[model samples]
Target: MTNHTILEPLREDQWFIQSQELRSFLAKVSEISAHTVDDRTQTLARLEPYFQELLVQQEWLPQKFAQVNPESRMGGGIGQWLLYRAKNQSLSIFSLVIPPGSTTPVHDHLAWGLIGLYKGNQEETVYRRVDNGDAQGHAQLQITEVRRLKTGDIYRLLPPDGDIHAVKTTSQSASVSIHILGNDTGCIWRHQFMPESHSVKSFRSGYSNAPCEEEEEKEHALH
Candidate 1:
């Protein structure tokens, strides 16, 4: 079996800093998500407008969270920084920074979420998995769409349909996108695909700012 780490929910909501804009957005998301908890489609639909509003507001995100990480967990100078996570672990907000000319591995987010370009530009290549998933460590994916997204562009991840994809920064500077997900995205094990090799593997791209349980344990041991 693939080794996976399960993280317990935090005792209280965690915020990197106190920002009124983020607080207001989180409140709206919580309110909308509570009622439509059973239906992910409706939840994402309801959350889109609020997410769009957050994306359009430029000054809310601090520069530190938007900067690229040299030791990126996702590689290619892709930094995933956590800004906020609900106490129950049902909601999370983060910024993904991709340096210019860098591309993320084709990956899947196994939860419903919204990804919006906060700065710069990106080329997103969305894919569809074709195999039945019976074979181990193997997956076949076909490109469904290639989208060029500029600042303020938004997209949705509704799984089994528009889930698997790769993104590359196509601008002079790094591209920063905001992700509001239903799960603790970077901490949980997900799939990363190798299209040319027709292979897949379990991957956990931990946040640059927030360490996972295993990472925390290692840090304690080293001290």
Candidate 2:
């Protein structure tokens, strides 16, 4: 039961475009994170309000990044679009788009994060790992909570706590959520679980718009 796959850091910070809203939010996050390096809980607590503010401003996120990917890695037309990423790979922000009636695989983000509903509604089923994770590809998950999220609703992801979860778009339209995480979530090899089978597998849900490595950066437009 490995925690996550290790990967090299990006050579430089990547910003999809020059958006003042996102730039300011990133600045605030960096400031708060730098001061709260020793405590992840404090970091999330202090940043929630800022994250909330960002989520409510619907215009901040471009429509292009909010669209579902036909060739999605997460399948079922789920789109994970990267908005910004740090050079060190310690932080990232992205938008997750899940089409109507689609559910994400039960997954765990190794790093702490804040996720907020931006558009449409969703049903989130949160799980907890009861086993020690000593057996490879094996895991025992217990459902801890299930939530219905509306626009502006937010949740925290602090590992071993509110970490493992699956989200389904309950609304008629596709649901879009903003994710601010402590790691390169989409690029890193994280765990995706199958609760019915009590199994786990390593997967990398790469961004629909951005490539993982620096060499491929040229393929996408930069502004």
Candidate 3:
């Protein structure tokens, strides 16, 4: 089967912004202001459907993100595209296409995030921040859970909800997802992937071997 076959088929009309669930989710996310864990969780739950709807509408996403390139300052990979950026509200929507044997670095966002799988299968491993040192030193992070996501799956990441995770495509085919987040300006603090020294290393260490060894090696040397 082709990579597109991995995606759940949908009617053209379904892509319209008519679903009550989606509308409600957008309303909640758009209005969320409180930074408390409880409040964030509630807002994320309501916004999950928006992520789902975007993923379901992938048929038109490429054209919308035609101007995006993975090598640009935004930093993404082949088949990955950014659809829109609302820097003023600290929100951005991204459509990722993961080629077979490809993987994203283990990273964390500055704010909460929502992910909806539209195409193929992906494996997600989440981490939790932990206090490992005195107040004068930095705390450590730990891997807490691992999940395998396929088409039609939706998940949230934030303060209360799990947010720190690493993802990998399941096969040679592409896996697509819609990412909604609170920060779009690219000014937020991004957690760098410290694979060799991080507290959470085992969860994503062996899942998928790197496909571009030469490029990865060059990047590693630069780091």
Candidate 4:
């Protein structure tokens, strides 16, 4: 579904955080065929109840996430890692950890996305693409809604609901969440919007941690 080299696996260096519950979730994700966007949406919905259990278990997270500094200018002032992606056009799962005061630039996901907050707090604003006035070929976005999410809050970003938004950590501690998206998001050509200039730019956010040996080889070949 994405335009980049596909990565397939359940874990890499991220294995240190795996649990039976997570493995079970992966098993369900594996059954998904990814034939259509709606099909994938329903698939993720089926696991919503189990995903709550994941929110309750906070010990499995890697320590590196807590150590991440919100002030770091690196990687959008946050930490992220790609835990898995289906070999074919199935799904991509990743984690985003944002420390207090960390925020991301306003952007849009070309594919469907679901975010489940497991720790701390966050505030997000959703935007509607009102115009594409960027002479340089970018989108113009308008804020549609703003919401604060706490642990176990699941936010949906499917079409028809204005999928563009900017996210920020509002808690004193680091906020961690599981982001499950359609296709390979890290390598896909998504939109990043500049509110001041009213411009948009294409961007691809690569994996923050590291992929497995097989995935690394495939990624190298793509380059």
lDDT of 2 by residue, 102-171 (tens): 9999998888889999999999999999999888989999998999999999999888789899999999
Q: Give the best candidate by TM-score.
A: 1
Residues 1-223, candidate 3: write the lDDT tens digits.
Answer: 1111011212221121234544454555566634444676776766665556656654544343323234533234434453444424355555666656667766665567777887789998887777653433243667888888888798887753476667887855667776676654133334444545643321111101121223446788999
Q: What is the lDDT of candidate 3?
A: 0.54
Q: Which residue ranges in model 3 land beyond 4 Å of their true spot?
A: 1-38, 63-80, 87-89, 132-139, 185-187, 199-223
Candidate 2 segments whose C-alpha is farther than 4 A from its true place: 1-4, 214-223
TM-score of each: 0.95, 0.94, 0.62, 0.78
- Candidate 1 per-residue lDDT, tens place, 57-130, comes to 98999999989999997999899999998777778899999999999999998878899999999999999999
Cα RMSD for candidate 1? 1.4
lDDT of 4 by residue, 116-210 (tens): 89888999988888764535665667788999989889877676464788889899987888877776676656667788777776676656765
TM-score of 3: 0.62
The per-residue C-alpha lDDT of model 1 at residue 23 equals 92
Which model, 1 or 2, shows the larger TM-score?
1
Error of 2 at 168 (Å): 0.2
lDDT of 2: 0.90
Q: Specify the highest-lDDT model's number.
A: 2
